[model samples]
Target chain A: MTKLLEANNLGKRFGQQTAVSDINIHLSRGEVLGFLGPNGAGKSTTMKMLSGNLAPTNGQILINGVDLLEQPKQAKAHIGYLPETPPLYRELTVREFLVFCGRLNLLAGKPLRIAVDRVIERCGLGDVQHRLIGQLSKGFQQRVGIAQAIVHHPAVVILDEPTSGLDPIQIRDIRHLIREVANEHSVILSTHILPEVQMLCDRVQIIAHGQLLFSDSIDALSKQMHASSLQVQLANAPSVSELSAIAGVVSVQTIADSTFRLHYQPDNDPTERLVSLAVANGWQLRQLVAEQHSLEDVFMKIVQREENSKDA
Target chain B: MLNLARNELYRLFLSPLAWVILALSQALLAYLFLSHLDYFMQIQSQIAAIPGAPGVTEMIVAPLLGNAAIVLLLISPLITMRLLAEERRNESLPLLTSAPLTAAGVVMGKFLGSFAFLLILLFMVLLMPLSLLLGSHIDLMQLASGALGLLLLIASFMAIGLFLSSLTRQPAIAAVATFSLLFFLWIVDWAGQSGHDDAGWLGWLSLLKHFEPMLQGELYTADVAYYLIVTLTFLLFAIRKLDNERLTG
Candidate 1:
């Protein structure tokens, strides 16, 4: 698959303070890359550079192999950006706004109409398509924002905090819409909501203090943090020393009086040996499930580690 | 660019601000037109005996167009203050900047859109002068030249207003700043009267100093060039402002 967007050594500085530094990103068609960062972590700055809304202080952006700085208009044709606030006209109806956005993106005639129609339907804006944007609910307004972003069928869609300020139901619906949009376009969705990233992103990039902390698929990220770890609950358990003495058990941490977290080597099938240990010792295994680290845990650990390194 | 211009025009017409400005301007101009016509009629016989006395074009049409220009000075700010300022306030400027449009195209498109609305007001005001054709003979060429002068004057004022709008996100600030700048330029020539030849540059740069000769039916290429220069200079400033916005946003 061809890469639809690429950033090399991207950096931005305001006065003397750096907003983002040496950022590199690549996205292919049919991929959704969740850009995760804490507040003030330069997520929006990076998104702005990719969308051509702000010029980078240093570095380069390529949209579909076209240099964004050298050929901005040609490169921007492949991009659609939905900023944090949605960039809506409160006085215009949803349909009118979409047509204006479509025309702005260089769509015309029947194709423009078809594109508007398809995006309206795709974003679930049919019910309020004719309503004025200010009259729509926040959920519908967010849909309109997404609708305008994708109306021209742009190859890359950059959404900054697309689900911000929405209710839970609205968030779920917007996430669903994002998934639908990603089927056809490369998407860069920036949010601090890790669960949203886990639910939607094919790959994830975590940024912290203007630096990249983690970049990989969600599964790969999980494996890196929780390799061969299991959470077990027993009716009658042995001492921690006895549990650590198991053939495959490398370490054991007490989670409760009878529950423990076991860590072992990746090549070792620790579950079988742990079950046998529990059976031999009459420690009835009530639960012995392999544990996958939550994204929040990994993210916090990465951020904490970065902070410690800086402090040292 | 044309698409943005078209959308700008649509939005301009949709807002009540444009319609209110149009109505109030027409009412004020009509009052001035009829008052001047009546005053001229009251003195017509007295002036008819005097050789080389002024007629309807000089007494009625010229001052009426002159008043129209002042009214335009007041309202063009109202029309143009929202052109780009509203987009910035609404945070919708990114929608344009992130599109496949050049910064120059966005600036030119906004200028054309605001100028188009001013033209509508100019045409309606011109109708007041053309109504003179119903009664007595009027110097049609003089009237046409004055009308062209007024168009250039307003176009240049709008360019200034567009530049001011580009500077601020507050439409009110844009409107007030535009009026302040235009008013300053309108009266800058007064300072020239007390100074020597070294200060003559003030009078040369004053808006009305260039506009007055055109009001008297004198159409010099220099006067037209003056208006064009002012319009193009401010338009370039507005375009640069947008370019800086994209760079620094």
Candidate 2:
């Protein structure tokens, strides 16, 4: 796949305070890279640098193989950015605003009109196209923001908190629009919503305290959410030592008078041996299930681990 | 650059503020023009006996245009206040900054947009004098010179407003600061009349001092250059301010 956006050693500092530092990120054509971070985690700062809205104190950004610092005009031509506030002109009608944005990105004549029409159609802005942006509902305004970002079909689209103030239905609509946009352009979505990343991203990067702490594929992250323990309930009580001695059982904990929680390696088999042992020893098995871990648990674990390491 | 300018003009016209400014200024200046003409008609025969005396262009058109300049001085800040400051306040400046444009392009586009609107106002004011050509002989050359001076003066005002707008995100503050700065420069030459030292340089620094000569049909290259230099200098300041914002903001 062609790399549409690339940043190396990207860092930004405002006076004595560092906003972000030593960050490296890249996106390929048609890829949605979710940028996850807590509030004040420098996500907006990084997005601004990548989109060329702000110059980095120490770094280089390349868009479509062009150096952003050396040739900002050409480099920015390939970038479409929707800042956190949406960057809208509320006085103009939706169609007029989109046309203006199209022209700002260098689209002209018939192409400008066509791009405006296409975005209005895609973003479900057709009904409100002639209405003033200020009069529209929040959802329609958000659609307009997304429409402007992709009006010229740039190679890389950077959206910062696109669904921040939206209601649930609007969030779903915007997410759907983003997914459709990902089919044509590489998207870097900066958001703190974990499920949003899980639903839309091919790869996810987590940033905290202005540093990139975790970066990997969604599948790898899902693996971290895999269950590593088994919850078992036997009608007839059994000794803790007897449950721990089962093949592949690493540890055992008594949850109730007759229940035990078994901790085991994912690759090992312990359920079959425990069941057979229960049958032979007259320990009646009542309930047995794996304890699943949610994505939030993994996120909290990662963030907490990073904090602890920093403190150490 | 042209696209940004067109967008600015489009948004400007969409709001009621531009229309209100246009109608009110034209109505006020038209009243001033007709009154000046009324006064000129009464004094026409009295001045006819005098040789090489002033004509209708001197008596009616010059003062009307002079009043028009003052009207523009008061309203130009309002026209220019939203150019950059409102964009910053509304957080829409990222739309321009993230586009494939330089800081100079953004500033010049805004300047041209507001300047074009002021030119329309100037043209309408000139039309009042042009209307007198049907009834009597008016000095077209003198009228043209005054219009040129007004043109340069309008440009200088716009550039100053734009530079000041770039310094703050509050459009109201931008308007107030622009008016205060322009008013000071307009009357800076008055200090020389009050028996101040270095009167020559103070007169040279006054915007109205440079503008007054051309209003009286005296078109000097130095006066033209002074307006041009002021326009260009403020434009450069606005561009530099935007570039600096990208670095430090």
Among these predictions, the greatest DockQ belongs to 2
Q: Candidate 2 at B166: error in angstroms? A: 0.9
lDDT of 2 by residue, B1-249 (tens): 988887788778889998999899999999998898888889889999999988888899889988998999999999989999999999999999999999999999999989988888888888889999999888899889999999999999999999999999999999999999999998988887888776878888898998888889999999999999999999999999999988976
Q: What is the Cα-based lDDT of residue A309 in candidate 2? A: 95
**Which candidate ranks first by lDDT, i.e. highest?**
2
Model 1 lDDT vs. the true structure?
A: 0.90
* lDDT for B155 (candidate 2): 95
Candidate 1 structure quality by residue, lDDT tens digits, A1-312 = 899999999999887899999999999988999999888999999999999989999898999999999999999999989999889988889999999999999999999999989988899888888889998899898899998889998899999999999999999999999999998999999999887888999999999888888889988765656757899999888889988988888899999999999998888867887787788889988998888656567777888888899999
Which TM-score value belongs to model 2? 0.90
Across B151-235, the per-residue lDDT of candidate 1 in tens digits comes to 9998899899999999999999999999999988888999898867787999988988888888899999999999999999999
Model 2 stretches with alpha carbons more than 4 Å out: A226-300, A303-312
DockQ score of each predicted structure, in the order shown: 0.64, 0.71
Q: Candidate 2's C-alpha lDDT?
A: 0.91
